[model samples]
Target: MVSSAGFPDFTRVVSKTIHAVVNVKNFSKKYSNQFDPFDFFFGFPDDFGNNRERKPQRNDIPGLHGSGVILSPDGYIVTNNHVIKDAEKIEITLNDQRTYKAKLIGTDPSTDIALLKINEKNLPFIYFSDSNKVQVGEWVLAIGNPFDLNSTVTAGIISAKNRSLGILRGETQSSIESFFQTDAAVNPGNSGGALINTNGELIGINTAISSASGNFIGYSFAAPSNLVAKVIQDIKKYGTVQRAYLGVKGIDLSKTEYLKVYNQETHQNIKSQQGFLIGEVFEKSGADDAGLKKGDIIKSIDGKPIQNIADLSFIVGTKHPGDKIRVIIIRNKQKKIFNVILKDLQGRKKIRTKEEITPSELLGAVFDPLSKESKKDLGIDYGIKIKEIRTGRLSAIGLEEGDIILSINGIKMKNPNDVNKVLKKYSGDVTIKSIKENGQVYIAGFEMN
Candidate 1:
């Protein structure tokens, strides 16, 4: 809409959508500020070379604030997972000054999305638009709380799409990062806000801003609304994201270095410059079952052109396991079409049930493999860090987040799967040795059966 002065006016869109944008505050337990994974700045280092002072403060810590978008009248809200990570209490405040405590439904760190629920009805909600239909150079309004300012809205145009920044860290290490790059003014407190079109339809969720100063510069990124909807639906119905995997590893050929390496290693003179070159095809995977071999360049999937890794990851990340996808690849300069049935990480072709959760999952905690730097700093060779603590055995036993799991029942915790392998077979006594985030050693023993 344009005003009488011939300028684009977003007053109507703001009035319709701003009511659904909300303030999300996360309250965490007090602890020493010693390199918290959740306390970093948009997945970057904490200080960012600013040479900020590091001083000890009081034990009580104030709640951190962000933004959220209401998706349903019954109080289903969506926000970035990092906003509420490791939070003990989540508070939601509506635009009309109403507040309520929120319950965490589920989280998918791969896409950096989280679902929350509150007991409220007749609440205002935003409508979701097809993000695939969003085009560049289109006007968009960013609605969120920036610097604790409530109901703030900024307007800009979509600058780019399908951008991957390698910021998100998922459990499977295959993070979905197809972001809508915009010139909208998104900031630290706008992590989970809404990005709506002129029609007041939500096209994306404001996630991260590419700024060394930890504020809005010239560009910002948002998670596409289509991907967010699929993730939330899976979380609400299945208690987890039904992540599908094509079971192949490759390098983006658009880069000069990767292209050179592929041609030299395979002794092939391939000249394609913008397709994903297959490095290894896992055995018994959907790609292998469909006769997709190594050295094939994937040109397209389901008729959509594959330009790079971001294009491929975003397309497949939205699909569920057991879904068949049409894949077109160029092998020896000949186009080949293959009907590939996607599978889960477990190699299953069916939907997974909540009851099928592994023993480690039943503990109500998320575990990430400790980094090499962290291992060396803690003087431990192998351990898994407790990323988040929910309501379960670990939390009930007073185990806090950021505690390292060195070993369980005398078996070294090398990978996340190791916890499941050990606990599933033993039913007697259980013992866990670990180190706290403060460098204190802790050991606990309990009966399993």
Candidate 2:
């Protein structure tokens, strides 16, 4: 016979988790009359048959609501980037129904984490658990304000980890994910909240749930605490993440069977059954500088055997720029060694300068100095016209074939030379404001070392 008293009571855990959940309400500007190509070609009204006279104008203010978790004793909160993105005003409500204005400290969309600060201090916060130690069947709790409901607490167990479902903002493939999948119910307003373990320790941040009907269908994912800690620390110190780059492009063996066959035929000396094949290395990149070539098969990095492209990317992301690492490569049935210094995605070596381009290796883009005609037509005093977007940071950010740069970090662009000069002056995340062909303005920010 089992004693019920010896069993852990989850009721207390739920109560504590609820206390950490917060209500985040923000004011967002709703842009009405947004241009639609389909509607334009068919000659439909800008509102798309909505009763414009009866409805409020498009530029009217809209109330945006979401959830968050108290991360510190001094009123520091963490939430989703999409939840508070472009918010005009942010107000936080506590478990006691007390409200206070919150200020955005920093945001990293790569991991969908945002840091916010409230006016008050000595607030109650939940401590983060070691997510790496959490097992798949361990009990967990999710706390958030879902569907405008305040401080809701749901219970479940860890379902999976290291999940990469490819549901992230922006079109580019980002390298910030190690999700802890859970069965806890999560919804739209639950973003930026807490996912806790049995002991009331935060293990992950509730992010996304997979469903066909736009509701929880027994699958949910949270950003693991390890990655969340990195993003939070980076955003606090540098206003952006200092992501490390490996500089070599490759495909995963699971995705490409030819690479597997090539590995068996070319590298007989290599003992490993799986590793990354070196594709094209960027000129002057860290890998190229380290003597890595296109034909070399990466056997190991820093003593860890490379299993696939994801393994390579994960290992590279764990390093920082200027850190020297040893790479083992098998080339032409011969083993070799290469010492490489890691670089940022932009291929920069240092963190002090804002200019981040090797002019000779611009990576397939036709850039010209800012011209008077370009600036006048774009309705900006400065910016460069992106004539083409080859494969690199620019192309990754959805800067298609003909986007025009308006500014970098709020500075006006004068030309390509001006863009380069201004870009080199900053070292962390740089926001590029540009206009599309349809005259719609969009901003893309990238981190440079």
Clash pairs, candidate 1, are none
TM-score of each: 0.80, 0.70
lDDT for model 2:
0.69
lDDT (10s digit) by residue, model 2, range 210-328: 66445677877888877777767765665445666778776444445666566667763333357776768988889988789986888888887776654565566656677788999
Maximum-lDDT candidate? 1
| Candidate 1 lowest-lDDT run of ten | 51-60
Question: Over all chains combined, what TM-score does candidate 1 have?
Answer: 0.80
Across 363-412, the per-residue lDDT of candidate 1 in tens digits comes to: 55789999999988877789999997653345423367899999998899
- RMSD per prediction, one decimal? 6.9, 8.2
